[model samples]
Target chain A: MKTIKDIAALAKVSIGTVDRVIHNRSGVSKKTKERIEKIIQEHGFQINKTARILALNKKYNIAVLMPTVESSSDFWYLPKKGIEKASEEFEMHRISVNYFHFDPLNLNSFKDVFDKLLENSFNAVLLAPIFLNEAKERLIYLDQRKIPYVFINAELEGANNISYIGQHSFDSGALAAKLMSLLINTEDDILIVKVRRDNVHHSTIEDRISGFKSYFNTRKTPIQIHEVILPKIKDQETINTLLHKKLTNHQIKGLFIPSSKVSVVANYVEEHKLKHLKLIGYDLNEENVHLIKNETIDFLIDQDAFFQGYEGTKTLFNFIINNVVPPKNRYLPIKLLTKENVKYL
Target chain B: MKTIKDIAALAKVSIGTVDRVIHNRSGVSKKTKERIEKIIQEHGFQINKTARILALNKKYNIAVLMPTVESSSDFWYLPKKGIEKASEEFEMHRISVNYFHFDPLNLNSFKDVFDKLLENSFNAVLLAPIFLNEAKERLIYLDQRKIPYVFINAELEGANNISYIGQHSFDSGALAAKLMSLLINTEDDILIVKVRRDNVHHSTIEDRISGFKSYFNTRKTPIQIHEVILPKIKDQETINTLLHKKLTNHQIKGLFIPSSKVSVVANYVEEHKLKHLKLIGYDLNEENVHLIKNETIDFLIDQDAFFQGYEGTKTLFNFIINNVVPPKNRYLPIKLLTKENVKYL
Candidate 1:
């Protein structure tokens, strides 16, 4: 709340002299300017910038890196819509978002797009890391240039990042485990099915699995846990072989599919008349919604994809326009969706 | 996005005439004013009121009504803090909240405070309804007068109100039952313990029970349910007798208490070494938190009372100042809380 006049009084200078020091104008003496600057910094006197913003009408371009929406899973579509909403809201403020999507299933597809993005003069970026190691290495240049970047959906640990807006995957995974523990019987074995159709175990998904295991191990729950991995869901032979091997081998009571591709598993469950088993999945995409409504899937842990996208874009815009640093890691609330609450969320 | 000049052009008048009409000045003829007003309404053109707001700088009073935070169960305290936060955030915008507390255990106490609130000239109100029928009846007058009101924790159904921001109790109950169905055995009896220390069968509680039963009945889940209603949880003989009878009577494997006073039952379970029973309760108070961490309680459905309070005050302020109509029923997301994710929410 300290005004320029207050700073000038503390520094024993005129308001005009303080203004010269603030704007780095030539009229003030070097000694007086230094004294006024010291006073301004000491008092944390932030001049109201609304007027200055109008005077210096600036346009900021932010790049958004995400995955192409897949029909098998349109989970990324919600976040895309969120980004669009934020972009439209901030349009009058002279901020524009340039979306650069990559193939979520292909590592080289992600690298190729990020490589092209490095050539642009964008103010900041919000990204979802698909190829983890390479994406972190490529983003090192942004850190060196002090161009702030935010992560959405997928977070990179022990990296130079401005902010992360997504669910805490490990905690979310643990939550899924807690849900699984609630519904599964001790006599029945639980399966941790990795529908690795993308041929990638993203860190977020890995952390979720780790967290899920930690929850069960910590409490020493007596239920048996089994693991199975399937190739790309589109590969009929692979899906059939994996499903047959797992389903025929064990008297599975519950299945935990950590990715949004739970819809794929839900399909197989319905087709095979495996209605006795309890199922916990993720995200609330159209396919998941239908399966959940029919009771093929019991509970879903929603990552709040729309909010993640909005906050990611909003955070980057804040840093570029207002120089405000968002919370380092903003963990979105983990929402458990059931037959009754699914429609509301 | 329409301007005064646009209205003036359409009305065949000068900008001054339009301005005068907008400000309700006497210089303009009534016919000209009527023409200009129609033009403004047709276009959804809003006058620039920032200058008028500063020129008229008026203070607004918002009344907050809720149960007093009980020393034993501080459930109401979270909402109180949220209201305080929203009040502080809007202080510079010329808004203040005047709290009217009531003993939640007594119906007459609520009537007394509401009667006192009715005498005040407050611009708006945000309330947590207790003794539902009476509260709704008293609030009808506010609706007739067009003084907007928002409901926070407990919502009124089939009422004249601006907005209701709270968790959907029935859906939340169904969610709890879903969780309970997951953890409880087919042969085990589930106890619906009504720790009615408050001596009110709040509709919120009844709705949650409905939702719980609906989930079990629809799914045809084989768990048997038992109900126990206690007038006062603090009465030692009653608590002891009920606990003894329920603990001894059936093959009880899980207990469901749809209130924040879950701590009362949790304490009994811990003291009597009834750790095998899977329990699903509500809220994230200190005692329930400890029980969850120590593995005595299985899961706690978070109502997010803080967000409910903040949104209630904020929504009323928006309507009073900006004339924004909030969603009629804003159901806060239901969160399934565990030891791992409790710290984050």
Candidate 2:
């Protein structure tokens, strides 16, 4: 095993300089830090983590930003449960957690939450980053503050966050497509429902639709794909009208909801007596479970939302208590839920 | 949350004495310890765990005892994997672990392993405690030395271990009965096979069978429950003779192997071209998966052996590092595995 001395020798720097860079101390010049890191990586240098943790004796606080569970959707509730469990376990080690919530459909709600959290002091942050542009603006301030943050549930581009904990959006969509294919014939039409407020962009939902299209396209299946956008102010009556019109106009064989609004689609399907159509959607809420038990929804793709919060808090705790930087991205295992297994969960 | 001072006042001890007992310090006398504990329980005192950990600085070494995983039955493999993962994450701290392995079938093997581990010092111990009498004798030494140990997989009587991390045996069996009830009719005969080595006692297996029988017994089902025991030594002719005689005499609809030897039973059913016998067994190993995929094994009850190892190691680490005592017994979630959900796992 190569030691720190070997990297220092190869980098043409003093041992102290190498040590400073390795520990991420601020005094080392950027050029020297880069050179030392390159040499260390090339040599596969391994540090005795025990000694490193013993040297660092500071506690840390992590701020978490996520959507609050409301009457519209309860998908965020599971993740909150995970976060609370992690907080209780880590409270003993001087690791404090502060949670901030925003409305999923309102970009301004997210912006306001981010602004308040940035003004407060925190060692680290974990953000869902639902709005692309608003999240980008917050990332700039986070960069200036040099506070490491992790992305959960959604990803933002051009941000130097420490890690990401969520699902592979595209893969999840492809999984949904496969489940849909099992219930519907190749020539049938499928509708993809995207639910959001009128002026808000949902890139995560778009990613899922892209993945769904990609899978069907590769399979050479002659399945017609349609998209439906519902305004945030739309009630069940408007949704019912639009869905009934679409079903009557086209022989819609399957309905795919790309977000947690599956419950809305499920309720429409049940009320309109459209039990013949196959439905695949996201998350496990009370509304979705009723539909699943009744066999109205063929499958529900779960991203293990609870784990995102649980692992995010745990990672921050490990960094604070053990002085360790874990992997930059942690992808949770994708789980497919059906009626048979849903009861067990 | 009542503070330690309140308990001290009620017990007529100094605040320092209460603090020492709460932290498990060695200086507190037995009479004071009992008095303080009684007062604490009466008031339902809860400690500020964060403050307690911050005030104390000490390292701990915990020893683990369990059966080694054999190729024939890889039941213990998952627990070992869980332990290894925890060890990697915890090596940076003052927590070190030593493992002692014994043959699951032999009582003498467990005694020998325990004797050797006792020679070396450990702050705490985690054991499977498969053999009740042998474990009782070994635990006497632990009590004399004032060492704390945890039980996993199985529990021993009259031994005051800190905690037990494993499944509730009866609940697991009840779950199996529910699954088996789904496959066969109430009038069909069911066979219960208890396979074990000659030297090993089958207390857990017996408890499982008792639970399985209780389900049918309460429902007043006409399903005939037959018991079969095979010697530890592998003899195809002997097993074949017993199986052939039982099958010829009765119209067996389901076979429930109350141990990890379900694969052997699965092999017998396949070899003899037996049909219409729904097989329910325990654990997920290479042999069992093969039979499960081939539709020979209908269901397998998984007690989450991996979590037993993971949580056991973590509990000991927390106790040593944070001066915390976990619950007396931690029951892992019982999972029912079938062909439908096996692929996802």
Candidate 3:
């Protein structure tokens, strides 16, 4: 309940002198600053946060660059909702966010939108870095300019990011393997599917598969494993033809699709009536949710994309607003959702 | 950046008159209030929250009632840490908490603590309702006084609470069942262990066990489950003797301990070197964490008991400060932790 005036009077200093000391302005003598601070600390005078924020002379602009929402996956909804919730919480602090959406599939679109963002004077950045190599290069430029950035969902390797708020991606892959081991039959081969266009953002996929393979080796399980990377641009029949041949040759007990686009395989299994195959995938998109509800996908690891964006923005905001840096690598707990619990979500 | 002075000037009213209208005080005339509100809205004005909170001359006290921390299980740390964190966050809001810890195994200790909490003039309560029947009786008196209370960790049957923030314990048990179905062999029997005394919190135990049993029945898994309840006061020798007999008599492949005292089983398993039995239990307690690290326990379901207390307290604080009522049952996510990822915590 003690004000700055009370502390100034107690310390036998002028109110303006006390204010200078409290705000760490250079004008105050070191002796006067120490005297004023002693009284302030003793009195436990908490600076009114609202007044402090209101007194801030300038507004903060945070640039959020992420993939645009499309029919491909509902993963975009998670971070969008997280950012929306944070905006409402941080509105009073003169913090505002400008959203810049980009096409996940097209590198040119990512560049165009990202270039537009750097032109504006933003205090910080929150991005997915789906276009990994370009983002890594840009991150160094951002570092030179002293603009803090955070990674959401996908943590690019060896970036100077303030923090990476997402799943421990490699462990999530091992968890998929753990779930797969439980759901499959003995002597049934496990399939690791990578549904992507090319080597763009390939490290993330590789880390996951490597982790999955290592788990089986650690357990010394004698299950045969098959690796398949289908072309992201393939036509339906071509995809079906390749999948049909794989399924025909191997006793595919359980399938592990280590990406958000699990719908592509969900379509293949359901269409072909591959009742023998148990499936494990990621994300909670509409198509995946539909498939899980129909009992097509056995288990969906919820990456909690919502909390990634929400916590990521909070970390950046805390640093900008309070000089409080959050943990550099904030790992989210991996959650497993089955048919029974998926309905409640 | 429009201030009250600017809005008051634009509205052609005194600053005090504008203040009355902004605070929704009774002194302002309806026509004058409407005229002032119109100008305030048009100017995009926000009420200074620091000034508003400063105007509140009273302090709020929230009574937190839960089980006392014992060396047997470090489960109490979760909610205590959560509540402590929330207290730090709400420290500026003039809100404080007083903890009342009770013994889980002793009903008399629970009653002694419950009676002591009622004497304080706390505006709100956050509780676990561990001693169910006695709590139900005491809640009527609390309701008559019109004090809002939120439940944490355990939601007793038919209690009128402001909100409940914890896991759907039943579904968590079912999830345990699903995991067990995957880990156990074709002929391996499952063991459900309840480490407690005298049914002090029996309903919670029964609900979890029933849910676990029903999952196997629904899935038509030909896995027979055996239930055992051990005395809380039994000597180490007695516990070892009983456990030795149980394990020796049955082909127990997987053990499910729904409570935080998975240490009882973990101790027996490690000491006996029961390599064949896989274990699943709850919390991130030191004992559980140690066990999980050594691969003594296979899986630990993280109920995030910290968030239960923290979110539950925030809900009560929001209702008291802002008249905002949160959801009645706020379910925390069921997190599955294995040996590979337990190191991160």
Candidate 4:
């Protein structure tokens, strides 16, 4: 039943000193803080939340940086929905959010966006560090300013960010490997494809391919595996011809496309009437779902991209509003999608 | 960039009046509040979050009420784990949680626990409303005190609670029916089991049964559907005897248990060597997992009970801290579990 005033009186300190001690704020002397803490423990003093709400008034603004959604893919759209949900919930508490978008393929665009964002102040930030080097450089200023940031979809090493929310890329790849193994015979060859635009280095694809190779190697599978890298250019006919030649030369029984552009390979496979080959890909884009429904893509791995964005924003808000520290890393569960269960999604 | 001083000067009011208006507290005249709001809008003043944290120093207490884990068929343990995880996250925020337990079938014990909790003061409460009338009675007191309470597992009608975090019983049952149909033939007869203690009313179980029957009725299949209600105290021998009689009399080809005691039916089927019948059940208990792995149970419908508890507590905390209103009813997604996917869980 003891209040803050009673604790302050018992500890021979002002109410302001007691408040500072309770909030762990700088200004109160260590000796007075220790004395007040002892009395608070002895009396089991509790703060009345209703009274605190009536007295405190504050607002915050948060900034979110992520890739812009283009017509090619709508993956970034899910995270934007999550950020909007958080913004709506926190608006009553006077918390506002400003969004900044950068092209996933353009590192200079990310640097320019971050430079503009740093000019304005934010209470907190949530970002997807897609352009690693540029993002790391921008985070140095965020560290100096002590503006906490959370990472979604991709993580940066040795950054003192608040948290990271995304998938365990290696495990998801292993899961894809297992699903692909189910569709092909032991003697058949497997093809791994990586597609990228001209100036973009998709590191996530590399991680997934490594995971797929590690799983097959650990299992000691006898199937011959081939890696194919296609440049993002006007050489579509050349790439298609190469694909046809590879299909004719090596009786490829299975294909693993390590990115969201699985639809491109799926279209080629259908056009060539390669119905005997099994295809496993990533994400649930419109084209991918069509191929999956027709059984052209035997399996698709979804990383629950919606939750990554949702959790990322919510985690930052929790820290800002409640003075709580969120977890350092949050990994979304790897979800396997098949024809039978894709409808529920 | 304008501070409180600027707003007060522009509104021709004291800084204290500006502060009072911002906090929405009484003692500020309406005209003065309007003028201060206008100035604030014009200038876009933001409060210093550091000052708010300094002023607010309160510890919150939450109480959780649920059934104790007594039987090997206890799925309630999963939600309890979720509650513990929430407690760990909120510990530094000075949120303390007290647990009260009751037998799922003992209504009087539930009443006694509620009576004691009514005398104890808490900021919030999280409960599993297993018993309808008793829960309604306690909720009336919670409403009068204006203490926000959330219901988990089952919801009561006209409770005026903050939110309900659980599964939609009918949808869950429909999903179960879909999974069961996948494992059986068109002309096969299906048996539905509803198990309940003598003192408890199995509303959730009945809802599931209704959904299951509705699915078959809509399909207009030639398969015969049968229902059985058994007392909780029935011995394994008695259950086995009754099941043998029913199987011989009706030639049941598939069994769908609409309660947590699906493992009991699995045991009877295993002992009687009724391997020909397709079995589907609820929950991920040890016994059920064994049946699933051995292929006795083709599928198990998991409602993600862990998330129900975790999200329930997190929602309550978010409401308390941010003065946010949660959705009236939040239903967890129905997850389908099979032997092929059980390892991931």
Q: What is candidate 1's CAPRI-style docking category based on DockQ?
A: acceptable
Tens-digit lDDT string for candidate 3 (A253-307): 8889888777788899999898788998888988899999898998888877888
- Per residue, candidate 2 scores C-alpha lDDT tens digits across B176-202 of 786677577777888887775554565
The Cα RMSD in angstroms, rounded to one decimal, for candidate 1 relative to the true structure is: 8.7
Residues A1-345, candidate 4: write the lDDT tens digits: 478789888888888888766544568776786677677656776566775464235678889898888654576877787888877876667777888988665667788888999999998889888767778878988878778889988767688677788876667777677666756778899999877543555556766887888889998989889977665523778669767877875668899998777887888889888889889999988888999989788778887777887788888876666534455667776666656456655
Model 3 has an lDDT value of 0.78
Shift in Å, residue A232, candidate 1: 3.0
**Docking level of model 2:** incorrect
Off by over 4 Å in 4: A1-59, A71-73, A198-201, A233-239, B1-283, B286-345
Q: What docking tier does model 4 reach?
A: incorrect
- Displacement of the residue B314 alpha carbon in candidate 4, Å: 18
Question: Worst lDDT window (10 residues) for model 2 chain A?
Answer: A318-327
* Backbone clash total, candidate 3: 0
lDDT of 1 at B147: 68
Question: Which stretches in model 2 have alpha-carbon errors above 4 Å?
Answer: A1-68, A71-73, A80-303, A310-345, B1-7, B10-64, B70-73, B78-100, B108-123, B137-141, B199-201, B270-276, B289-295, B313-323, B339-345
TM-score order, best first, reads: 1, 3, 2, 4
Winner on DockQ between 1 and 2 is 1
Order of the predicted models by lDDT, top scorer first: 1, 3, 2, 4
TM-score of chain A of 1: 0.83
With candidate 4 superimposed using the best TM-score fit, by how many Å does residue B5's alpha carbon deviate from the native?
Answer: 52
| DockQ-best of 1 and 4 | 1
